[model samples]
Target chain A: MASAREMRLRIKSVKNISQVTRALETVSASKVRKAINAVTATRAYATKAWQVLRHVAEQPGRDSLHPLLAQRKSVNNTLVVVITGDRGLAGAYNSNVIRFVSQRFDSNAVPVKYIAVGRKGRDLMLRRGKKVIAEFSNLPAAPTFGDVSTIGRLAVDEFSKGAADEVYLVYTDFVNMGRQITTVKKLLPLELEGEGLVEDFGNKSTGPTAAYEYEPDMRVILDEIIPRFTALQVYQAILESQASEHAARMIAMRNATDNAKELVGALQLAYNKVRQQGITNDILDIVGGAEALSAK
Target chain B: MTIRCEIISQDRTVFTGDVDIVVLPGAAGEMGILPKHAPVLTTLKYGVVKIRKGGKEEIFAVAGGVAEVQPDIVTILADRGSENIQDIDLERAEAAKKRAEEYLAKSAPADTDHYLIMEAALRRANLRLDVVRRYRKSGMRIPPSDN
Candidate 1:
C-alpha cells in the first residue's frame, strides 16, 4: 500500500497538472467562441457568394474564353492551397489535413506545388521536403474577406497563366463543439457542387433551385460573380477551419483537465485509506505493549 | 418617388433606407439617381455620396466599385464606407495623403500606380474633411477619431 504522505504528494501533483489544463481549457474555449461567432456572422455572405459561384460554374466563363478552364486527360502540374492555424495545440487539426494531402498527391505521377496559408502548415510541409509555391503568414486573429481574396486571386492567376493545371484546398470543417473534420476540396475548374450550409436560404427544410431574374444578362453577371464568389468561398473556409481548430483544442484540453481531476480524486481516496491503516497499526502496537506489561 | 439606398462597409451594412435622391461620385462624373432610374452599372470614385433620406441628408465617403440602380433599388458594391463622421482621423488622413503624394511623385513615370495611390490619398483626406465638417455642423460631441 502507498504511504499516506506519498499518496498525498501524488494527489498534490495531479491537482497542479489539473489546474494548468483547466486554465488552458478555459482560455481556448473563449477564443473558440469568438472565432465561432466571427465565422457564423459571415456564413450568410459566404453562402450567397457560393450561390453566385455555382451559377457561374454552371456556365462557360472567361476561362472558357481563356486558358484556365482548359482541361487535359493527363495531369502534369497541381497546386495545393494548404490552410491551417498559425498557432498549435489543436488535436489533429493540422496533422489530419497534411496527411490527407500527402495521400492524394505525394506521388511522382504529377508534380505538386503547395501554397501554405498559415505558419503551422508551412513549417510542417517544408520539413517534409514538399515544394511550397507561396507562403502567406501573419493573418489576423480572425481573417477578413480581403485576406482570402488576395490569396485566391493569386492561385487563380497562376492557373489561368498556365503555371499550374489544377488547384485544390485542404482545411478543416467545424461540425460542432466536440468535432472538427479535415476536408480536401478542388478549387479550380470550379466544382459543380459548390459548398455551403446546403439548403435554400432561410428555408432549411427545402432546397435552392435556379429561380431568379437576371437584369442585364446572365453571362455578364456570372463573369463578375464567379471570380468574387470563388474568392469568398476560399476565405470563408479558412475562417471556419480556424474556428473549429480552436474549439477542438479547447475540448481536448478540457477533457485532459477532467481526467487529471479524476486521477487526483482517486489518489486522495487512497491516501486517506493509507493514513487510516497507519493509525490502526499504531493503536494495536500500543495495546499489545500494555497487555505484555500487565502480564509481567 | 424615392430610392432605396444601402451603403455597406466590409464589416456590416452601414446604412439602409429610402431616400429622395442620391448623388454618387462616379468615376465618369457626378451621377444622380432618382426614383425609376434606368438600370445602369458604373464604377464609383472615392468621394462623397449624398443621400437625401427623408428631410435630413446624410453624406458618406465611398472607396470605389460598381453601383447598380433600378426604379426602386439603388444598390452599391463599394470597397469601403464610413458612417461615424466623428471617427475620421484628420491628422492621419493628411499624413497618408502627403505620403501617397510623395510616393506618387517618386514613382516611375510609366507606372499607372501613381494615379491610383494619389487618388486613394486624396479620397482619404477628403473623407476625413467631409466627416469632420459633418461632425461640426451637427454640434454633436465627437468621439475621438479613428483612422
Candidate 2:
C-alpha cells in the first residue's frame, strides 16, 4: 500500500493527466468535425470523377488510350503511398496503417518503395529499413486539393517512367465517427474493376449509360481527365485518412481521460482510507495515554 | 424549360440551380448551351462560367476542370472555383500570381511538375483577377493597377 503522501501525489498526477487528455479530447473533437466535413464535402467530386473514369474505361480499345490505364506485363517494383498521422497518441491510428502495409507487403516478391505522407509513417519506414522515395509531412489541418496533388503527380510520373510498375495507396477509410478501416487501394493503372471502387457510391445500377458527344475528342479529354481523376483520388484518400486520424485521436483521448478519472477515484478512495486509519490510530493512542494518566 | 446546372469545386458545390443557359470556357473555345441541348462532355479552361436564369446572370471563375452537359442537367467540376465574385480577393490573386511568376522564372524547367503546377496557379490567379475586373458589380471597388 502506498503511503498517504505518495497516494496524494499519485492522485494529483492522475488529475493533471486527465486535464491534459480532456483538453486534447476537446481539440480533437473539433478537428474531427472539420475533417469529417471535408471528407463528406469532397465525396461528391470523388464519386463523380470515379463515375466518369468508369464510363471512359468502359469504352472499347481503352487500354491504349492512356499510360495510366495501361497495365504492365511484369511488375518489377511497387510504390506504396502510405498515409499516417504526423503525431502519435491516436491509439494505433498510425501503427495500424504501418503494420497493415508491412504485413501485406513484407513477403511481396517485387521490390516495394514508399512515399510516406506523414512523419510517423516516414520514421517507421526508415527505422525498418524500407526504401522511402519521398516523404511529405506536416500537411495543413484542412489540406486543399493543391496541397496533395503533388503526391499524385509523383505517383503518375513514377508509373509513366516505369520506375514503379504499380502504385498502391494505404490509408484509413473513415466509415463513420465510430468506425475506421485500414484500406489498401491500387492507385496506378487506374483499376476500374470491382474491387478498387469504393462501394459507398451506392446503387451502382443507375450508372450513366448515355452515349455522349466528346468535345475536342475522346482521346484529348481522356488525356486531361485521367490525370486529374488520379489526383482527385489521392486528395480524397488524404481527406479520409485525416478524418480517421482526428476521430481516432478524439476517441483515444476520451478513453484516456476516463481512465485517468477512474484512477483518480480509486486513488482518492485509498488515500481516504489511509488517512482515516491514521486518524483512528491517533485517537486510539490519545485515549490510551489519557486512560493511563487517569489510572496513575 | 430550364437546365439544372451544378458547379462543383474540390471543396464544395458552388452552384446548383435551374438556369436558362450556361456559357462555359471549353478547351476548344467558349460554348453556350441551352435547355434540351445534346449531351456534351468537354474539358474546361481558365475562364469565367456564365449562368443565366430569367433576367439575372451568375458568373463563376473556374480554374481548369471538366464540364459534363446533359439534356436536362449540366455538371461543371472545377479544379478550383468560386461562384461568388466577392470571394475573389484581388490582393491575394495578385500576390499569388507574382509569387508563381517569380518561382517560374527562377526554377529550372527540368522539374516539369513544379513548373506546370506554378503555371496553372498563375493562370488561375490571372483568371480570377480577370473575372473580378470584368464581371464584378460596379459598386465593388476596382483593383489597383500595377505601375
Best by TM-score: 2
How would you encode candidate 2's per-residue C-alpha lDDT over B57-140 as one tens digit per residue? Answer: 777888878988778878888886555576788999999999998998886674588888788888888888988888888323
* lDDT agreement of model 2 with the native: 0.84
Model 2 clash tally? Answer: 0
Off by over 4 Å in 2: A107-109, A126-129, A193-206, A210-213, A217-219, A293-296, B1-4, B17-23, B30-39, B46-61, B70-73, B84-147
lDDT (Cα, tens digit) per residue for candidate 2, span A223-262? 7888878877888889999999999999999999999989
Docking class of 1: incorrect
Worst 10 residues of 2 chain A by lDDT: A198-207
**How well does chain B match by TM-score in each candidate?**
0.68, 0.85
Q: How close is every model to the real structure, measured as TM-score?
A: 0.67, 0.79
Error of 2 at A112 (Å): 2.9
Model 1 stretches astray by more than 4 angstroms = A1-6, A33-62, A65-75, A99-112, A119-140, A143-154, A173-185, A192-236, B1-6, B16-42, B48-59, B67-75, B84-122, B128-147
Which 10-residue span in candidate 1 chain B carries the lowest summed lDDT? B138-147
